[model samples]
Structure formats: C-alpha cells, structure tokens
Target: METQLEDLRQQLDKQCLINQELQRQNKDLEQRLQEKEKLLQELQGQYHELDGPSQRPSNEPEFRKSRAAVISSEPIHETLDIAGTGVKKTVSETSLIVKAIQKNDFLSRLDDEQIAMMVDLLVAFDYSPKDEVIKEGVEGDSMYIVADGELSVTQAGRNLRTLNSGDVFGELAILYNCKRTATVKAMTNVRLWCMERQTYRTIITNKSKKKREQLMGFLKTSRTLKDLNDAQLSKIIDSMDEVKYQDKDVIVREGSEGNTFYIILKGEVLVTKNVNGHQKQIRRMGKGDHFGEQALIREVLRTATCTADGPVTCFSIDKEVFEETIPIEHLELFDDSKVLQETKAPEKSGPSSTLKFKDLLPVLYQEGRHQGDPVTLGVGGFGRVELMTTLVHGKYYAMKRVSKKHIVAKRQEEHMLFEKKILKSIQCDFIVRLHAAFKDTRYIYMVMEFCVGGEIWTKLKEVGRFDEPVAMFCTACVVEAYAYLHKKNIMYRDLKPENLMLDVRGYVKLVDFGFAKEMVRGEKTYSFVGTPEYMAPEIIKNQGHDFAVDFWSLGVLIFELLAGSPPFSSSEPQKIYAKILDGVFKYPPYLSEAAKSIISKLCRPRPGQRLGNTKNGIKDIRHHRWFSSMNWHKLRMCQLDAPTVRLIRKGPCYINFDRFPYDLAKAEEEFSGWDRNF
Candidate 1:
C-alpha cells in the first residue's frame, strides 16, 4: 500500500512539471503576439500616412521649395595646388598618421602614394583635458588621427567607449558632409593630425583626373585609334594596365609573339631592329607616342625590339580588351588594304505612336474605360499602380497614378518631373518603356509597359532565395541595363528587387527612375538618396558620388538575391548606414569564391576602386569568373533562357503580385499646371 502511494506521488509530480512548461510557453506566445500587434499597428499608421496625403503639412511651401534647392546645382570641382605647399609633418607625426590610417578600414584601401599625400596634408591640433574635441549633431569637415593621449566617446549622454593613440575619429567627415554621431572629449592633453574633406577630395580628384586626361590625350592622337569616339576611348583608357620598366629593360623582344598595344606616359623607349644579327637602334619614342598597333589587329611576331631608354611608364592594353571596345572593322583601319568608311549613324526613334497621350485619352476617359473597377496591381508610398486595358485593341499597360497632393506635400515635384524626363530619354530592352504620361488636377499618370511576371521581390519572398544560376542570370540582366545607362552618363541610384520586374519571357526589366540622375563623366553629385540597405559608403557619408554608387548597390543586390537578405540590413536606417561604413559583413558559406570576390570588389569603400568604376568600366565585371559562362550578347538580345521562366505564368497575368485595396481618395485641393508637359 505504501509503494502504491509513492507511485501516485511520482505521477502527480510529472503532471505538475508538464503544466508548468505549458504555462511558460503560453506566456512566451502571448508576449510575441503583443510585439507583433505593436509592429502591425505601426505599419498600418505608416501606410495610412503614405496613402492619405491630407495629413501632411499643406502650408510649408517655402520649406518644400528650399528642400529641392538644397541639392548642389553645380558639381564640386576642387583643384589641388600641386606646388607641394601643404601642412608639414614631423617624422613622428607622419608615422602616427600612417599607423592610424593602416588600422582604419576606410583609409586602409588607399595606395602607398595616396597615403603619403594624405599624410603630408595632415595639420596638427592640440586639445586640453575635458575639452570637447567634437560634438554630436554638428556638421564635421575634418577627420583626425590621434597622435597622443586619450579621448572618450559618448552619444546621447551615455558613455560609449574610450579611444587611445592610433585610433581614428571623425573619418566620415573627411569622406563626406555628415553630422557627428557621437561626442568626443579629450581625457588627457591630446595632439591630433587632422585632414579636411576639401583637401582629401582635391587630392583624390586631381590624381584621377590628371591620369585620365593624360591617357585620353594619348588615345586621341593615336592614328590607329583616332576613329574611336570619346566613349570608346574612355573604355580603352580604363582597360589599359600601367607598366613601368627600368633603364635598359627590354619591353618587347624581336620575333616574340606580340599582342599588346602600348602608349608611353612618361620617360622614353628606344626602338631597335635585329639587322644582320645585331640590335641596331632605329628610333626613340617619348611620352604621348604609341606603338604595336599591328599586334592588336592581328597575331604577329614583334618586328622590332623596344628597350626602356630610362625609367619608363607606359599604358598597355591586351588585344582581347582592345577588340572588345573597338569594332573589328574599326581596328582593321590599321591595315592598308582595308578602306576606312564612315558609318552613318542610325536615326533615333521617338516614343511609339500608339503610346501618344491623345490616343490613350479615349481609353482612359471615354469608350475604352473600365466598366466597373480597375485592377490594383501594386501600391507604394507615393501612389498605386493599376492594370489598364484598351477596348479597341485590348492591349494592357500598367498605369501609375501618383497623387499630386502627396508629391507636393512630400516635396517630390522635382523628382517626379525628373523621373519622367529620364524615362522618356532612355530606351533599352532591359529597362521598362514609358509609353505615355499625362497629369490631371488630382494626379499624374504614367502608362508604362506592363510586365506580366511581376516584381523579383515578390518572387524572392515566395522562394526564400535564388540558386547560383538564377542569381547570375538576374544579375546579368541588371548588368546590361546599367552598362547602357552608365554609358549614357546616367546613375540609377535606387536598385532593389522591388524595382526589378520580370516580363512574360522571364527577362528582368528595371522600373522606377525617381532617383535617377544624369551626372557628367568625372563629376559627382552630393545627393544623399538611395535605399538604406543598398546605399554605398560614399552615399551615406553625403560625399559626392558618381556612377560608382550604382555598382555598390549592385553588389548588395547580388548578395540579397543569393543569400535572401542584403549584406547590411537593420530595423533602423542609422544601423544600416553604420554597417555600410564599417564595411564588415558575412558571406554565406554556400557562396562561391567567385561570387564573393565580385561582391567584394563591387562593394569596396572607396568609390574609385569599385570594380565597374575603374577605367575598365563595366568590362571588369563582365569578365569576372562568376560570369565566365555568361553570353552577354545573347542575354542582351533576350535569346538566352531566363532562370525565372519556370516560375512565370503565361500572358498578362498578375499572379506574382499581391492585390492592394483601392484606398486612394480624390484630391481636396487642385494642383494645377505644374504637370502640363508631363
């Protein structure tokens, strides 16, 4: 009987333990539900705020006008004084700067010469104990390297960390215009070597500009390359590799297989020929002189031996790169037998006749109007997209209806017009075509080519992530689009899966040009605009950015496609920017070395060093091992099968997109005449 009582007691203990576990799990689930509800409420508030423009301030016209004006109207053009007049540094100070920079991720990418130049530009400043070295929420223009003593970092009255000698601070200031994030107070008497943003920009800009100009001048004077246009010349300049030779060094040996074309930048080269088994000097080539044109045209043995007369620096391009940039017919000009004929430029075609605003007016307002309701394809912060069909032809197009009141309230008038201008100007197969645009008193409308396969973002969400082949194919389509745009001197600032849409054929088409801007070659725009996760370090710093910013975003897109998330992401924009500036992100183990390498090259902190930004332009990216099997020509022509083909439905379907409620209301006040030309 005692044994039976003990068994009952053990059973009772087990039941109590199980009950306790169930209660704990229930509590956890309840907490999670509360958190989810909070998040959902926040999202709904944002949605309403975006969809309903009436809540936005209507009496801030001056502020709205000034907002667009804040963007610099002129490109920054600061020339460095090359007279060797800069801050003089002591040997110890120079060593300190070097050490400090080497330990910094942002500055470590600089080459030895650039580092030396920056070190020469550093000015010394001393701070006393308890003094504020830098304050939070103040725009900073100078970066400092601690030469001695210690400092304390604080943000919002909270102690963050301590800094010692060799530590760097305010580095972003030197890179771009940004408010200091944290306050730094000197804990001891401190000496810092500082560099100003203007000085730093001058050094980088002058160096790059001078080199490009010199190479361009050489190419322009070359008889073999004279037929090439400025754009083609730029490509050649980017592909050329800098080679230096010591005195008496043989640059080319007679009778060796030659396939490289050379242009001398500095020093001299002595051209000699083997005459009667003896090397006899024939001619001397100096700076601006070019040789070996025949080698690029066809495979041939070197006819002459060229030796460096002294220390010589020359730009050399491989035959493959040379041929890729210049057409074979153009290269054939090097041969006397080939006639140099002028090729007539193709006639530029305007927008399609069927896409005229007048033609679409009937469909939108009269006979072809929808009998009941239009299909809401997608919704966005500014407006919504709807599926519109013409009755007579039964052709479908995506009509983007943006609220003018929302645009004005958000101070996006300039952006809206600019987007229309850019869309109308560009014509590429990989880019969605803008068929028509017209605005009413209430909203501005854009008729764009309907993409049936829908946003890559939606597809990615459904599948979680893409395999290597799919990612590569998608990336390739974007590459083609960017190549076209970059060549036209346009920068597509916003690149995300949501902006990338697939057609019925599963080919990717880039949509949305709200942030697109045309920047002249070698010029930088100081616009701090882009998606947080995809923004480059330069863009985050508000430093001047050019086409290079797009490449950085491209890297992020590639990572997101393969890994299912961007390399740097956070719930907060500030955290995302911090991660971008830190330049530390993990690559998934499943990613191939080639994929990682291309991503790394594209995501370099220095804009000038990014893969597509280099002189080789987009060729470096195209030739990357990750895309070794890519048939660029075929892809551009849409001949290659897209990886998303299996996922796409047949003709004019919206299966990939989520349906949104038609919540847009009529404008309370009319916005007249601003969009007359749209």
Candidate 2:
C-alpha cells in the first residue's frame, strides 16, 4: 500500500511539471503575436503617409525601390482608384492627383478633405462688380481661377465677351513675366482662387515636367482643341499664360504691336475700333475664342482693339509658340476684304504712309522751310528724344532720333509701331503725326510733324497755372487725341508732359507710343513696363487695366496742368502707387467744381466706377460744365485751337533723348528727373 501511494505522488509531480512547461510556451507565443501586431501597425502608418487621401506615391522607380523584393507589387493608380471606389472617389483618382499636382482647378472642386489639402495651395481674392482684375502692360506674380461669378475681357476700349464659372485667368503673365494682354473685369460680384508664380514653380518641381506633359496630353482630348494635331496642340498648351481683367477694361489696343496670343478659356469680351472716326462696336467674343493672332504672323500692328464687357479671364500664349503652332498659311489666304475696306490713299501722303521717316524728311524739309539744328526732348533712364534736323528748300524738319541702345533697352518696338499705325492713319491737328520710323543699323529715326514750341512740360513750368481757357483748350486736344486712340483700341500708358509735344501753334499734340499697346477685349497681359510717375495703381500692382488707364492719366495731367504738379508726387514710387490705390486725388484750394467732377470720375480706383471705363465716360466728360461751351462733334474733328503760346527760339536739346556713352550718366546723377531710378 505504501509503495502504491509513493508512485501516485511521483505521477502528480510529473503532470504538474508538464503543465508549467505548456503555460510557459503559450505565454511566449502571445508575446510574439503582440510584436507582430505592432510591426504591422507601423507598416500601415508608413503606407498611409506615402499614399494618403490627399497625396499618392508617384510611379517614380526610386519610390518603389525600397523593400520591393519582399512586398507584393501593385500599381499606385489602380490601388488608389480601387480603394477610393465610390465615396470621395473624385478626390482620389489620378485625374484629381494630376490636377492637384498642377495646382489647377482642384481647389474649386474638391471634397472636404481634398479641399483642406488644396486650400493650403491657394490665395483668396474677393471683388465687387466691375472691379479691374488685372491690367495690361504690367508684370504679374500670380494666376487665378474663378471660384464664382462672371467676368468680361476687353482690349482697347471694346468689350469682348463674358466669362462665367470655372474659368481660369492670369497664367500668361505669371509664366513669362510678360505684359498683361487684356483687362479682366468682374461682371458680377465674384471671388477668385489665386496661385502665384512660386506656387507654379513648386508644382513643377513636385511633379516632374514629364508628368505635366502627360497631363496636358490627356487634357487635349477635350473637344475645343480636337481639330489640332498633338504637336500643334501641345505647342499651344506649352505657350499658355494666364491673365485677369475687370469689367469695361481694355485688353488690346488697336494700332499697338503685340507679341502674344490668347485663348479665352473663360470670360466675355468686346471688340471695338475707330470706324470712320467713330468708336464703333464691331463684334463680341467669349469662351474658346482666341485673339492677337496678328501678332503671331508678321509683326503687323494690331487692327481692332478689345475691351472687357465684364469680369473676364483668359490663358495667353507666347508669340514664339503662338506663331509656330497656328496655321500662318491659312492667314495668308485670309480675305483682307473682310477686315478692311479699300480706302483711297490721300493725295501725296498728306499725313499717312508706310514710308520710312528718312525718305519723307527731305521732302517735308524742302516743302516747310527751316534750318538744321539739334535739340533734346527727354532724358534719364529712357535716354533722350533728340531732334535731328536738316534744311531742305528753306524748310527745316525735325526727325526725332532715338538711339538703338535706348530703343532696344526700353523695348520701344511696340511703341514705335503704335504711333506709326494710328498716327499715320488719322489726320488730326491735335494728334502728333508720326511720319515714319527709319532704321539704319545703329540709329532709329522717327520723322515727326515739327513741334517747334517745345514740350508742354515747360509751359507748366513757365506759368504756375494755365488760365481756364488755355487749360481747357489744351486739355481738350489731349482728350480728343486720347479718345481717338482708345477708339482705335490703343492705350497710351506713358502719358505725361514729356510725351506731349506742341506744334508751332502750341496745340497739344500727343506724342510717344513707346508704352502704347493694343488691348484685346477679354484678354489680360502682365509686364512691369511703364514709367512709375505716370503709372496707375492697378498698373503698379500688376492688376489688369484697359482704356480707363488713359482717363486716370488724363486726370493726373489735368491736375498737373492746373496745379503745376501732380497730386500724388513723391520721391518714392511705392508711395505714389499707394496713393493711387487709395483712389484719392486731392483738389487744390481754388479748383472749379466742373474740373473737380471730371477729375474725380476719371481717377476713380475702381475701373468700372471710373468714367472712362463706362460707355458714358466720354459723353459724361463732354457734358461737364467745364466743357459746357464745348462741341464734342467739332472736337472730334481736331479743330480746337490753343489759347496761348509760349514759344522758345528752338526746341529743347537732344541731350535728353534716349542715348548712352554721352555725358548723361554724369548729368543724370545731378538732375532729378534724369537721376531717378525705376
């Protein structure tokens, strides 16, 4: 019995030992399971980081390189597309990725999570109806996509068309640092989603250019561009730029040279031109319409000018690509009869011809009777405008000679063309007749109608202020000339006394198209290309503008003429720009209500609020009390005369004309106007 009991105890001990070993093994297995779960969680977190709802791991081989041999392979697009199948699917598809990566319109059409990601990539803008969205001839730092409402595009003084919903603008200026092509205006209260040039650069860096190219390829499948070949279409895509403008803004100006073409991806615009000396609305354009094609061809001056009818947006193309992609051969086949009627040439090139200035110099000199002399008109960074005179048959004619150095530096080719085309086409006493532009490898000569009385700038210096009659007459002439140019779809950006040449009779003859541009309706351009003192606030900010700029300039000119200085004069251009943005034109103590009213209307900050941007601006000015005794119809005929004459023995010296290698570098260091830097 004792031996049997001992055996049972030994068996129980053996069983207990076995149970303890089994429990130890089970605890070890549980610890290993927890370790596996932690590792899996870490892996999942890493995967989420790489391919989140907002971002995805690109198909770059480098990204796929790590742990490739161990993991199962899966295409990123296929995986994301499948995973995001229905809910918020639009925000996850490759198309959204492409759009988001490009910083395109993804922000405008995103789900809540996707919007949060996109909001990180945008700038916001709010505008009231008819606000100027962009200005022509100003440099731009950003592009915009409309989040809501309507816009119009304009060139010169004509309304092109209207744009609504999902439109993009301001891309061209951001892309090339070129001038704004057209003015964009809000047709209704609107909001714009903005992106800067830096943002675009970031996108390009983030998504390789090859991916961008691929995306563009996919986009070209849209119907509007279906007719074009892939190569030609790609050229257009590559050349695309963006611009924005406000209602009644002038886009392109008639008679100005342009090196840009535009595609109206969104917005409305109007086309207008001087038809038989009248501001006539010829046509209107809208989304999918393109303009400035003439620039893509031979460097012909612009024909009709355009203006924004409402807030507008557009994508612009550079001239090089625009020229290469478009069918120029088709343009040659264009029936000129459809564009312009055959007008009889004036007998003996009265004031209009395509002849060189030099060729016309000898004839005009011989017919007019005068002695040769050298005189300078302008100075400073722009160099000078020197009168190169020679006597022929007792008549002396002044040929304004601008050196190649100055011409090339200031990029005056477009300006020269503007003066030539419009001035040549019209015969107006108040308008400076631009005879011809003669180039001789080194020097550029512009044969101008001799203005022996000197610049109007000097007149303001001589007399503290002009009497009402004198001021009215001079202002009227300038207004008429400006009206004509605007009617012809041109905007003279640099409007100051320096550019206002006077004929022998002291009649104000508007001169210098150096900063002139043909505005297209419903188009925007960006270029920081104008003199600061004369620049409008919109110009300084790189917002698009139109013919309304002329009105602002006129307001400044009138104030200067009356008060002997501009209301916003300052040593700093920034200060001046700020003042302009403030939209205040301080009236002198004794100014007339009529003059004040006109200036106020003209200087309004809102392009749409300004008299000039409105269709009635011209008529409104015409009916003002200051012009109560004036005749609009007769003024249009250029029959107005100057009330006083302050003639100099000779015009100013050519020492001021655009030139270099002269004593100017030292002289400019001394003089105020000449010394100032932009």
Best by lDDT: 1
TM-score of each model, in listed order: 0.58, 0.46
lDDT tens digits, residue span 97-121, model 1: 8888887766776657789898887
Model 1: how far is 185 from its true place, Å?
Answer: 2.3
| CA-RMSD of model 2 | 35.0
Report lDDT per candidate. 0.76, 0.57
Lowest-sum lDDT 10-residue window in model 2: 66-75
Instruction: Give candidate 1's total backbone clashes.
Output: 2
> What lDDT score goes with residue 461 in model 2?
54
